[model samples]
Target: MAIFKHLRVSDGVAAQGDGKLPAGDPDPPPAADGAHGPPVTNEPGSTKAWTWRGDFGASLVVVLIAVPLSLGIAVASDAPLVAGLISAVVGGIVGGLIGGSAVQVSGPAAGLTVIVAGLVQTYGWAATCAIVAAAGVLQLVLGLSRVARAALAVSPAVIHGMLAGVGVVIALSQLHIVLGGTPQSSALDNLVELPGQLASNHTLTVATGLLTLAVLIAWPRLPQRVRVVPAPLAAIAAGTGVAAVLGWDVARVDLPSDPLAALAAPQWPDASWTSVAGAVIAVALVASVESLLCAVAMDRLHDGPRVNLDRELTGQGAANLTAGLLGGLPIAGVVVRSTANAKAGARSRRATVMHGVWVLVLALVAAPAIELIPLGALAALLVAIGVQMVNLSHLRGVHRHGELPVYLLTMAGVVALGLFEGVLIGLGCALLLTIRRLASIAVRVTPQHGGPVRVAVDGSLTFLSVPALLRALTAVPEKAVVDLSLNIDFMDHAGVTAIDDWRTGYERSGGTVRIDEVREHWYAPGRSGLPRPVRRTPPVRNRAAWHPLAATLSGRRQLEEGTEEYQSHVAPLVRPLFSELAHGQRPTHLFITCADSRLVPNMITSSGPGDLFTVRNVGNLVPRHGEADPNDSTIAAIEYALAVLPIKTITVCGHSACGAMDALLTPERAGNMPYLSGWLRHGSHSLDRLATRPDGPDRLDRLGRENVLQQLDNLRTHPAVAAREAAGELELCGGYFEIAEGRLHILSPAARVPV
Candidate 1:
């Protein structure tokens, strides 16, 4: 006993907010930052020291991907190529300095291309720039009002469907450019003109576009070192290089002789006030939603400081204002470069800011080199990106939530009608679906040959379901006899009155009706002219009916009443589960525990039917192979369970203040009871093990834990248990239950106490 005196134990399970742990156990340790060291504090306004190496390297990786994408987006929007470059620089520098997100990169996004193209067509480029600036001002006001988070209340299905529709439109229009032809005004026109464009052979342009697509598809499968260069840059460069060397006649990028001379100031539109205001609001809301959603999405890619959405919205407004003033396209957070930034090991906002500086340098010095790229290659890149936006993963998620109809309707509306109208349609459909689900109810009737006919009602009962409920009640014939059970979870005033009126009429038609409410007493209160009960819990039963009192009733009478209660209230609810498991069982674990009146195996394990195979005996003992009585039942039960069932694990449980352990302490008390004394002999090894350790305050608790551990060892002495354990086909565990504390402590095999 002295060897075990210094052992320490910790709680495995205890009541929440109990303010207690094992006597000498230490508190759990804090989580570590990473395998390297503590996180670097280089966020936008942080005061701690900065780490430059990771951020500088990540910036170089992001800048290479941003330059070509900016040129392509501007081409697709029909804006001057320099406008795309201007927005990239402004978004990176200004957005990185003031935005709430630590690593999200901002630039012109593909999602805004449809709206921007329509605006430019109607108002001209200069007027479109003014509208963008106005939108920026509105965004700034909304951010200042601290209503940024409320924007996320819009349904995710609508947002995703809108993006998918935009992708479809972009792909249809850009496909014409890929075939060396001008795109038509709308998606439908582009689709209709596709065959005519395909008939006229533009061999060199088609060759370059196909080459670009091939390179983009095959780039990811290359070696890691080769993939360090992005797929977009490599694909475009491959197409451009082959078209240059072979003297192929393809459409090349056309930029102004001097890139700095392309900057232009925006002008006010000549349209009416209402038209201008509508365009401004559309740009503001779309940009705000896309950027905020992108910020939330990028947060999942890193363990950095969370995005401050309000600050992020304000920063996006500032960037757009600068872009619109300098003749750049509308700017928002971009997912492509942000993913690259995270994958490149960016630690802070420094990476985002530095990447913008690199793009500024590219626009200044590499204008001639960028002009060498073919327009066909850029068109091919946009086509691939547009097609990917209709993601299959998004479709599967919406289908699982039963929102696929809303999603499909929104997408169809956006493509056929317009973006705003499509979103309104989606909102209306979602409202209707919600109302339909809330008003659903079900009623079922069953007839017994000799007993009363059983009728059950489930779900919420409201005025919407009253008509349906009455129709179901008509299914019962004039009702010779009836047992009506109301298992409804909710009932309104109209519903209770309906049920009461039916019962009164049925009884008057020469029939007997007995009403039993399992969940609530809605009908009882309504018939008594009393107000409905505020609490949802069922009415409490009288304890005196089943309490073990000799003066009140005999033991047989109490047992019969308890059986009747179970049959009347619980049988119908559990009937389905019992019917499913009636034919066979495949329990995963075999539970062995004491046959104590207070220790319920199922309650302690929190397992339902067909989850555990249980064995119970006094002292919770298992006899060893060498030492066993002639008619041993515990050993035979173990053999049968291991041989017949698919049991993965076996558990031995012992409890505190156990009567068997107390009897072992004073064996003379059980000398007169032969059968009890013989059964207690199987726990002799536990007493020997306890004797070797020094006694402490909780001797009974320690002996009970030792008995659980000893029983696990005894189980291994069987040939089947030993062979299965050695082959890793089975596992053994020990648990000690403290009756007074109502806690179960898991025991470790290597130690004598619970761990």
Candidate 2:
């Protein structure tokens, strides 16, 4: 009745003829102390009491495993067994208290065993310890400065691959220890000895190791209650028990005389500075990798929260320093143990602290009993840990993705060289691949509907991307109006030149080229920072009333015929084209083209001087309205043709095989000629449009045609042209001058005009 709370207890008791009390309140009664149960702690999910109990239970489990493993790992590392135990205790106590994550358990790990052993042999234990302490200080500094995120910047593939390689090394190296055989001095030796050892070793020892591995692997699949028991612990206990009962002469820990005697505090010597410095560096690097990896893993496991990595590093550093002071080996956040604690229902850092307490109690009170644990069995446990870390499925996936070269190189490099060196090589390769990817990028060319051929460039277009762009542009028909818009997010010098050259060539062959809005200063102007304006002789007020002799004398060819020979020869030859203009006859259209020798607009247009008024430039560009300087002779000619010549239509023509267009199309050479590159970008739009078309002589023809249309559009922006066109006093047209065929193709009035 009391358990059910608010039940009719009095009535139930009366029915039973025994009255205890009446439960009248709806709420449950307070505990025996007349207070509500302890308020819930900040631990994740569980209530305070439940979380505390879980921590105690998980800690008990961790301690049972940490003690034996720590001692064995230290012995394997060639450091004093006490060092490992001290590290575990300090890592558990300090790291748990100060570190950012709640569930992480810190202890000496197998990954660092080789490094520790080597450093101890070379630097001596005291110096090694000092180095470890220095590393700790470094880590603390890094953590305090909040730069621990630097570790995350390392590529994920490289990090995982490195860890997998380490897993292999650990598994291979521990095989000898598990078989009651001493491993060789170096990893290479160990690798070479593997085949012989497998062949000659006692089948019984190998069988025992294999069985141990199988149990650890299978244990996780068992029921939840049984799964709570650490697999490594179970494997060790079973293997050791079997070895003992079978009377196998397997290698076992060589306990010190008075096992507790080795537990003295670590001593620092004046001469130990060198060793200490080395150890600290090694420890800092190893611990940082381990701790940060564990923190990231923990963040994933606990979907609700994440750890502050810098704070975590600081805590780990403090732990290592404490461990060194306590005669312990270096420690790091161990992923396996942290994961185990989480699965065991640990809700807070209290679990880590509790685990430390258990290590302390067992080390002080039951040191003798722990000595019975066999080293071979511990080796088996490590072999299992190493296997678990390999992530074979992920490796297989990497291989399937055709990244085997990178994967294998990383694996082989790490195994053959060392973790850091191998990873660096892999990183270098990855960087090369990245650069290749960037270099291979090409401009995106899209065809527009009933408009100029428009091409869009997304990534940076540089010299590296030129060939591809050229091929794309040349693919389009030269007759298409190329609304070549170099709306580029980024463009280098080479890209500018390629575009310019393409435009020049295209315009020379009679193409309409239009460049959309360009970034200001993308191109430079002439000496006056503006396009040179076209100049023309004052127009006759009344052509009909003008004298024939004066009109003939004022024509372009006549003006150039200052010499008597020019007057007597060239002027007479050109007299026919000028006679109509002299009599006040107006040409219907004007043609604009490049000044390249290959492109003679008059010859391509097949129009005599009076029939076709033309302006020529290296890159046939129409200066924006008002951007023309007074001295820009080309501009003056264009203005005169548009405003004073009584021309009804204007044609901006481009030609193929033009040098300036070629320059505009190639941007890589921009750095060498900064001003020219900047100037050439003005024609980039037409070049881009050309790039979208198919490559061929025909494509160049298309570019030339498109360039003409673009120029016509450019003319429409001119105030006089716009006003005249709007007033129906003038018309606009684009023409493609094909240099190869020695022909002109008119691209307006719904017909292609041939010359």
Candidate 3:
């Protein structure tokens, strides 16, 4: 809950890519910069009375657009014509009263057409209403929980693929109605009968449908004043005229003369719990996502109050609950009406409430006129909407991101199978794409000036990428030295065997295959086929961290003496965790240690990159508190580490075999080397304390522990460390590494037992 407190409220401008609008509706016109801003009104929370006249006028504009779309969506959903109007009325009144978005119009949306249709087919129209009611309950729960914003995180690829699939299915099934025939049992059935329907003489309904489709396409490009009537309304009116003039026997919408007769009670779903749950979740999630997306788009076109996403979700739920109970299709924030409302300059949510009032008034007053509208005309409208869903622009965009296959597969699946199946397939494909990208391997071969090709493989070279690797290897010219460089993080058994087999085969074919590794060691130097055997740490008496001496002794040392232990043992144990940081480190502790070879702090302390900000020198020391000496590199590293990193802990780790300590403790110092003698001066206090130790012979070991405590005291003198320690944000710890015994001990005030 705390993590989500700062959840972002985006304008969802890119959500238009999700196709929230009715097919073919141009993007909402943008308002002039500050046209309705400050000079026209006060800031967002202003209490000035709004212009009711302006709101009412704008309500009429949205009502004109919502009526035809609602009717068409209901028809596509296989519900009575009045069900669409009921949804429009309830969405306007209930949602407007409580919605977060002031200008967004709430009604039946194109996105839910296929979902509603399927519900109607499975459980009948009355039971489908119950499903809508159940979905509304879910939406209410999500909104109240304040998790509604999280729904917007659904991948754009899945959403677009889903809508495109819905569009294809809607077109195929509704094409049957446009051709003067009832819809088939399934999309596949409809597709099979489509050719036969085309061959028959269904002339009049086809003519009406074609004219309706034509008007919808042409109406928007007409003269400015005439365009006030929405394209859907204009197209429907023209189609009605054409049908009446021809005296054709076409399937027409038959609504009761008295609108009250449209009311129907919800029926309990007669199905298994799993199916019912699926239906409820589907409607709730899809409606919530689409509504929220529309609300965000509406906020962009208006200068009024921005949409409070949770409240918008709650409002949609209330409207859907009301619509479902009243025998209506489920409702959401309709983008077409929402965008139109903003463009018309509606002052408040009053415009949306009034639009609902208009729809209710129209249903009673205009029942006879509504009954005259032909089903073919509505089907034709749906056809255009569906066809628009197979968007070329959206396709091109998805293709650029390599998601074209997802879109195509989804669209095909919907047409061939069903809505949920198509969506699942598309989501599966998108998931695969994401996984491939995350686990992607890059195999490159650069032809050198005079040498053979330099083959480098980056990322996790697992079995999935073996085919490509083999092809690249096969392309190498014969009798050539292949400089193979593997900058990979992981290589499984299959990958290792494939590469090994290829290398041997290539070398046997008169070619020299030289294998080199940057991050991963494929195999040992002499043994080329198998992975190098490693000596894993054995159980210790105290179960402590890996001892540096043990690590150094277990493995055969490398040809290079100093790095032998690390390269063969320590490096392998740590490379997997730190190889990604080959780029950089973001350590929190600045571990200042001596440069003595045997004193391996990482091996003793069990630390890696990003765990520590380290500075090693002759004597692990901090020079002065508030002053910077240009010659002191130790002081400069301290300052840089403290300032640049999120360093909370500063550790000065001193050791037993420290040459710098010996130089300081000895009577005969490096008299010939003045620079070294001067550098040893920083540890003078630790040397003076060593002589006072009661243990005479073991004073050298005691000096190591005392030296760490002295460095810790020196660290506090720095202004940066002092300030942070005072604020209780930074910690200064004293520690020493016992080289001969291969153990570590902590020194708070004095050296204690091994820690």
The numbered model that scores best in TM-score is 1
Please provide the root mean square deviation of candidate 3 (C-alpha atoms, Å).
14.2
Q: What are the TM-scores, per candidate, against the unseen true structure?
A: 0.73, 0.57, 0.57
Q: Give the TM-score of candidate 1.
A: 0.73
Candidate with the larger TM-score of 1 and 3: 1
Candidate lDDT (C-alpha), each: 0.79, 0.64, 0.75
TM-score of 3: 0.57
Scanning candidate 2 in windows of ten residues, the lowest lDDT window is 8-17
How does candidate 3 score on lDDT?
A: 0.75
lDDT of 2 by residue, 17-61 (tens): 011111211222334554333454676653566657777877887
Can you tell me which runs of candidate 3 are displaced by over 4 Å? 1-36, 39-54, 245-249, 443-755
